[model samples]
Target: MSDYLVRALAFEGSVRAFAVRTTDTVGEAQRRHGTWPTASAALGRSMTAAVMIGAMLKGEDKLTVKVEGNGPIGPMIIDSNAKGEVRGYVTNPQTHFDLNELGKLDVRRAVGTEGALTIVKDLGLRDFFTGQVPIVSGEIAEDFTYYFAASEQVPSSVGLGVLVNPDNTILAAGGFIIQLMPGTDDETITIIEEHLSKMEPVSKMIERGLTPEELLFEILGKENVQLLDTMPVGFECNCSKDRFGSAIISLGESEIRDMIAEDGGAEAHCHFCMEKYNYSVEELESFIDEINS
Candidate 1:
């Protein structure tokens, strides 16, 4: 099935929730990056959360999530916008290890228990917001929970999971974010806390073919959740040959010429989607003309 996300309010608007199913979305990323089981889990988990967070933005605004953990997987960078578009990459996509004590992917080992999770929001009009928090757990979900509380000052529960098949492909990937808005009553908080503690992992929910709305219903109760809207989500990269050529042009005519001299062409690789853009000698000369003109 296709990937999509839902935004809803519950507890009479005192609580905000977002849920999404990202199986195909993450599957594509795994195929593109050839991520190992553990790395796939880390990247997929981050992407799932990042896309849900992206739903919090308005038009034209976007955010970047950076996970700089002190582990073999290195740093992970993900970008998402209000449009339900997200793309990401880990510095070491092939990183993997035996299952942890829980028999799940050793995400903490691959992600490390140190470093920081930083978010930079581009709100347009030159308005930007930056938040940073120490990585509480390399598990991705806990780190985001800590980030929301410590950096954004919002008490939130972030559940993220990515189940990889034996072939290193994604089995199921999804997550949910429940945020307690200001003025939340104690009773509501307690109820949500209880539900989250007893509920199954979000990945299992997705694996069972639960929709985003159903996932939210399980978390917040069908009666309390007020369905807002849903948007399709997927792996999308905006990189193009023209875009990379322009970047090379910014390096000045001398740099562009050096590429033509040293190599027959210039190749630019996108870390997000692993897409490569090639600029032939003819294309390089054209860029030089554009720079000179």
Candidate 2:
């Protein structure tokens, strides 16, 4: 099925939750980045979580997530908006390792536990909102949970996972985020915690063909959940040739002259989508004239 996420409220708005199935979406990222099994797992997990978080915003608002770890994967960055668009890249995509003790991809090893997860939100304000928290578990989900609690002061539970195939492809990818709104009773918190503790890994569920709605039912109970809006999610990048052209012009006339004299042409590559835009010497000369005039 196509990648999509569902938003819901349970127990009459006492609980807010989001669940997503991102197998195809994350797979696209793996193919784009040519990420190894472990790096794919780490990047996929972060992207899945970022999409769910992006759903929390209003129109035109967006957020960027940065995972700066000391592991082999280096730093991972994801940008997402309320419209369900997301783009991300890892500093090192070729990193991978054998399974850990649980016989799963060694994401923790690929994403070291020695750094922070920072989130910058652009709420259409003069100053953007920024939050940062130390990585509690390089596992992605737990680290986001810690981020919400420590950085945003919201008590939350985050479960994110990604399964990689032996051929260095993505098998499954998905996640869920459940947050307790204020005024939740003590009894309700305990019950939700119990259910969360007994839940299966999110990626495994997606691999089994479970939808986002069913995933939330598994966590919040069918009788307790109040279904909200649903949104389609996918791997999207905003890069364009026109944008690259503007960038070339921004390099100034002298720089454009250097390109024309030395290389005959210039090529620009986008890190997020691996797309290349080529400009001939003629195009560079035009840009030089535009900048000079």
Candidate 3:
């Protein structure tokens, strides 16, 4: 099934929740980046959480999530907007290791226990917000939970999971974010915590083919959750040949001339989607003209 997200409220709007089924979305990233099992888990987990966070914004607002850990997989970058579009990549896609003590993907080993998770939000009109927190857990979900409490100052519970196939493909990937708005009573918090403690892993629930709404129902109780709206989610990259060409043109006429004289052409590669754009020598000359004009 195609990926999608659902928003909901519980306990008369004192608690807000978001859940998403991202199997296909994460599969696309695995295929495009050739990420190994461990690396796939790390990248998929981050993207899963970031997409849900994206749903919290409005209009043209967007955010970028950076996971910089001191492990073999290096850094991970995810970009998402309020519209449910997300794209991401890890520094080392081929990184992997044996399962951990819990028999799950060794994400903590691939993403070291030390470093930081940073969020940069671009609100329209040049308004931006930045939040950074030390990595409390190499597991992407726990790190985000800490980020909410320490950085954003919201009490939140985050559950993220990615199950990888033996051939390094994604089996399932999804997550949920539950938060308490200001003025939430203590009784509501205790009830939510009790439900979370008895829930299944988010990845397993997703693999069982639960829809986003069902995922929320399972976590927040069907009787308590008030379904809000659903939005489609996918792996989308906005890079194009024209966009890359514009970037090259901005390098000035002299730089364009040097490219034609030395290399005969230019090639631009996108890290997010692994797409390459090639410009012929003639194309290079036109860019120089465009720059001069």
Candidate 4:
């Protein structure tokens, strides 16, 4: 099934929740980057959480999430917009190791415990919003939970997981974020917390074919959840050959001429999707003339 996300409020608006199914989205990233099992799980988890955060924005708002851990997998960078588009990459795509004691992907090893998770939000205003929190757990979901509580001062529970196939493809990937709104009564918070404490992993639910709405129901209790809206999500990049061409021109006539003389053309590769764009000799000549004129 195509990937999608849902936003909802439960417990008479005292709780906010977001859930997403990101199998296809993660698969696309894995295919493009050729990530190994552990690296795929770590990067996929970050991308899953990024898209849910993107849902929190309005038109034209965007955000970037960075996981800079001191592990072999290296730093991970993800960018997302309010329109549910997201793109991400890890510094090292081929990192992997044996499964942990829990018989799950060794994401913690691939994304070491020694760094920080930082978020930069551009709301199209004079100043951007920035939040940073130390990595509490290399298992991204718990780290995100800590980030909201510590950085944003919002009490939240985040559960993100990605199951990778033996061949380095994505099997199932998804997550959920449940937060207690301000002024939420103690009793309501305790009940929601109880359910989350005993709930199965979000990836397991996705593997079982549970929808985003159903996942929220499990977290908030069906009687208390009130579905608000759902949006389709995917791995999307806005880079194009024309955009790269303009960038080449921005380098000035000297740079364009150098490319034509030394390499016979210019080649650009997007970090997000690993898509390559090549400018032929003719194209380079035209750009050089445009810049000179």
Q: TM-score each candidate.
A: 0.98, 0.98, 0.98, 0.98
lDDT of 4: 0.94
In model 2, residue pairs whose N, Cα or C atoms come closer than 3 Å (at least 3 residues apart or on different chains), thus clashing, are none
Q: Candidate 3 has which clashing residue pairs, if any?
A: none
Model 4 collision count: 0
1-293: candidate 4 lDDT, tens digit per residue? 78999999998999999999999999999999999999999999999999999999999999999999998999999999898999999999999999899998899999999999999999999999999999987999999999999999999989998988778889999999998889999999889889988999889999999999999999989999999999999999999999999999899888888999999998999999999999999999999788768
Per candidate, the number of residue pairs that clash is 0, 0, 0, 0
- Model 2 misses residue 201 by how many Å? 0.9
lDDT for every model? 0.94, 0.92, 0.94, 0.94
lDDT (Cα, tens digit) per residue for candidate 2, span 165-188: 878788888999999999999988
Error of 1 at 155 (Å): 0.7
Error of 3 at 35 (Å): 0.2
Tell me the tens digit of each residue's lDDT in model 3 across 1-293: 88999999998999999999999999999999999999999999999999999999999899999999999999999999999999999999999999989999999999999999999999886678999999977999999999999998999999999999888889999999999999999998888889889988989999999988988888778999999899999999999999999999889888888998899899999999999999999998888777767
Candidate closer to the true structure by TM-score (higher is better), 2 or 4: 2
